[model samples]
Target: VLCKIACMSRSRFYQSFKQKLDCTPLALQQQLRIENAAERLKAGESVSQVCFSLGYANLSHFNRRFQAQFNMPPSLYSRKNISH
Candidate 1:
């Protein structure tokens, strides 16, 4: 469904998407989830709750990926830039 919506071949999409977006399909989803977490963090939501809400079975993994993408940790981004 997502592939169809994206109007791309599975293989081509995999390569191009990674090259353009810097992540796989699922990784992109997780990245969005990380952004959502960042928003919630700014809203004074707890990291643990955000992790669970994002359906992450491994909170540590989520943190690692989120940190890897955005430089600082999700919690830090929320704490520092909540107003923005």
Candidate 2:
């Protein structure tokens, strides 16, 4: 869809996107989702809520991705960031 919008072939779009962003589109998308999840978690949302709301079907997969980005699990991140 983005390739079509950009009027570029799939390979060309990927190459251009990587050259400009320094990462694949999927990586950037995951990073954005995790960042959004962190914000939602800090706002006192539950882990399961954040996971599923962000279209993550598997809790463990969401945990792994969140941990990779933040160096902590979503639960711990919420505990540390949420206001008492």
**TM-scores of all predicted structures:** 0.68, 0.96
Report the lDDT tens digits of candidate 1 across residue range 1-84: 766778987887789888998879887787787888888888878888888888888888988978988898777876887664
Residue 82 of candidate 2: its Cα lDDT? 99
Residue 15 accuracy (lDDT) in model 2? 100
lDDT, candidates in the order shown: 0.82, 0.97
**Candidate RMSDs in order:** 2.9, 0.9
Candidate 1 ranges beyond 4 A from true positions: 4-9, 12-23, 82-84
Candidate 2 residue runs with Cα over 4 Å from true position: none
lDDT of 1: 0.82
